[model samples]
Target: MTEQTSLWQDETQSADFAELCSALYEREIAQLANADIQSPQVIQGRLKSLPYYIKRTAHLMLQTQTPLDLDVQNASWSAKQAAHMPLSGQEIAEVNKWYLAQTLTHGLVVPVATTTHIVLDSIDRIDQQNHRFRTNVHGWFYLNDTEQKDKKVNANYRLLKPNKRVMTAACTGHCWVNDHKTNPVIPSLRELLLSCAINWRNFKQPVIF
Candidate 1:
């Protein structure tokens, strides 16, 4: 690398970058929670500002030189796998809907912008080879829509790889996900938010569960 490029890389590898990433991550999640709202339109407006926060958090993490914790490392590994997997638009929407519902259900807030950033950033990181994954959404969070009769159309994610399971979502904007057999339930969206909250409360640690 050229000297200029080398210096930039070195700066990213510094302890300061790690601290910045940690702080940004906490801020992003906390901001989502603090934006709690009942009106979808109002919530949408609040969500509009999330992409900047998400991107900043992601960029800092990618530039950091420190070794990430197991959960984060594993999440990145899953993103790599997902990049290779074929995710249809409908599939993506299904997963996003499930997550949104779960977040609202758990009394945690998530704007559409945040969800888009999380999904797109994971894919972008893999495509650009950024060598980082900052999202925990690695599965299809929807079930097959054809089988539903009432068309209530709740979020049922169908995760691929690691586990080819279906997550039957609740319609009450609650964080509930059960499988077809209801045996091995996937991680609910509420859990993800709670992890983020805990990480923020615990000195702005990196929590991408």
Candidate 2:
């Protein structure tokens, strides 16, 4: 077996495998982000190609028994039982960095036409003109309440009151819009990460969620 293949089979080297995969993933993200794309079509094409690149990179880095067949739409591969092996402290940190990069990439991608219905779970009234709210699925949104009147503000609050849901479209500039005529809500990336159970502050530890 090749040295890399042996490394994959060695349970003790699981951390090393995780580190390698994380590095490769980071490199791919960097290359994609730094590319000089002159047009929207080019950007879309690159985004479309990311999945295949990820699959191929994982298979090559893991040296799995069954190589990932890119031709098959649903083919999948994973590192042997070692995939479930607990990662070391450093490995966890490296993995978290990769996760953060992935999230940032998601934020950078152009918004699609699809819209989702999200139920508001809670709200934090920031001030007269701005507020923040959390959703059950999508995460936190920053609502700009330009209308300062208490009656109008209360009406807007009622529109997004807890337990009330609305149709939302993800847009550029981290902005999300509801089907209702209310002002557009911008997503707070930090709070959004927290809502997803990822704490950006403690990258040194493994994420329990």
Candidate 3:
């Protein structure tokens, strides 16, 4: 395992994982506010806020995991504590989507799109003015065991696979995936929508209810 890999990783189940995601995300809101995050800032502010979000989420997800040995690393640190369980991949993805939603809030549905899905569970808005996409779409959700799988060029950046080995974004998703943030926070409704923006737009949309 890479140094980045958690020794005490989260293997928690779906419900617990969901709760943990919510809690950590709530904590993240405070951290961002304390950092004075307002809109229109560069991506750096978002990036800077990440570790706290990821680490906190990670801690919740992997309850068996203790925090870093800050003294050994010479990092001024928070006190050590433990939770009842470990986080799981679902939780990680949940929180990850939360962060992603926050990042991708308002986008003009680009034209030349391949699929027609328009909304996921938490869609915020469809910028009617800017969307040049050819097809009209409704929304879509995971119908069953819920999976996505495909392959793509590093260039376009749309993830083609839902359950690929790395499951996060391609290219390590430095901006997107922070395995470090493995905890109990679920993405805010908006964040969750935004994170799954593509699915919201492509897989979920184009439906008629």
> What number of clashing residue pairs does each candidate have, in the order they appear?
10, 0, 39
Local distance difference test, each candidate: 0.31, 0.32, 0.31
lDDT agreement of model 1 with the native: 0.31
- Provide the TM-score for each candidate, comma-separated: 0.22, 0.22, 0.23
Q: Mind giving the per-residue lDDT tens digits that candidate 1 earns over 123-184?
A: 11111122112233431122333423333433433222111111011101112122111121
Q: lDDT (0-100) at residue 181 of candidate 1?
A: 18
Q: What's the lDDT for residue 18 in model 1?
A: 53
Clashes of 1: 10
Among these predicted structures, which one has the highest lDDT? 2
Clashing pairs in 2: none
Model 3 per-residue lDDT tens digits across residues 25-140: 56555655676545747546775776565554433333322222212111112222222111234342453353334323334221111121111122335433332111122232
